[model samples]
Target: SADYQKILKDGGFVISMSGKGNCYDNAMVETVFKTLKAEIIWRTIFLSRLEAEIAIGRYIDGFYNPVRRHSALGYRSPCDFEAAA
Candidate 1:
């Protein structure tokens, strides 16, 4: 929409949209969401919105970024990959 484009432009942000039916355009993000759903969201029950937010934050910061191995990074965690780079 023109409004959305205007908002993005006004905010000094670049907008990139995938074409309709283009699964490969956002494959990495889709994979991450799928993994998060399977590994964390599906396994835990949250009592409140805050609890869920904290849990997801911990999962990404404490485990995923620092400890979890990723196949794309030669089985290294993101932190390790960054360190090597």
Candidate 2:
């Protein structure tokens, strides 16, 4: 624990932690990973790491962030929500 704290302090990184035994703090990230796996990862077989990287980058940039609607953001895509903000 001290090592982790020291490393964060040295790196000037802010640590965000959930309360002990509370999983809700990471729910949003977990949901995104689950969606990615279901929608993109599970559907394709990558021939190379580079291809996978590019495909994933395209999926996130061309589709997910700009096109996919998120119910948590009142059914708006992230780009829409950000522009509105």
Candidate 3:
């Protein structure tokens, strides 16, 4: 919607380069979702939305950001890559 576009623009966030349903602009995000599902989501059953949120937060903060290595980051975790930069 135009209002959403305006909100994003006002926040200095760029909208997708392509139209909806086009995955080219968000391939990396899609990959992350896939991995998140495979690694944390599919294996766990959450009793509530808050539980899921907490689990995801821990997965990203305690492990993914600080420990999981990525090939794009030369096999270093995001925290390590950012520090090296």
How much lDDT does candidate 1 score? 0.95
Off by over 4 Å in 1: 7-14
Cα lDDT, model 2, residue 76 = 97
How close to the true structure is residue 71 of candidate 2, measured as C-alpha lDDT?
A: 100
Which tens-of-lDDT digit does each residue in 1-85 have in candidate 1?
Answer: 9998999999999899978999998998998899899999999999999999999999999998999999999999999999999
Indicate the residue-level lDDT of 79 in model 3. Answer: 100
Write one digit per residue (lDDT tens) for candidate 2, span 1-85: 9999889989999988877988788899989999999999999999999999999999999999999999999999999999999
* lDDT of residue 63 for candidate 2: 97
Total colliding residue pairs, candidate 3: 0
Poorest lDDT segment (10 consecutive residues) of candidate 3: 14-23
- lDDT tens string, model 3, 1-85? 8998899999999776788788877988998899899999999999999999999999999999999999989999999999999
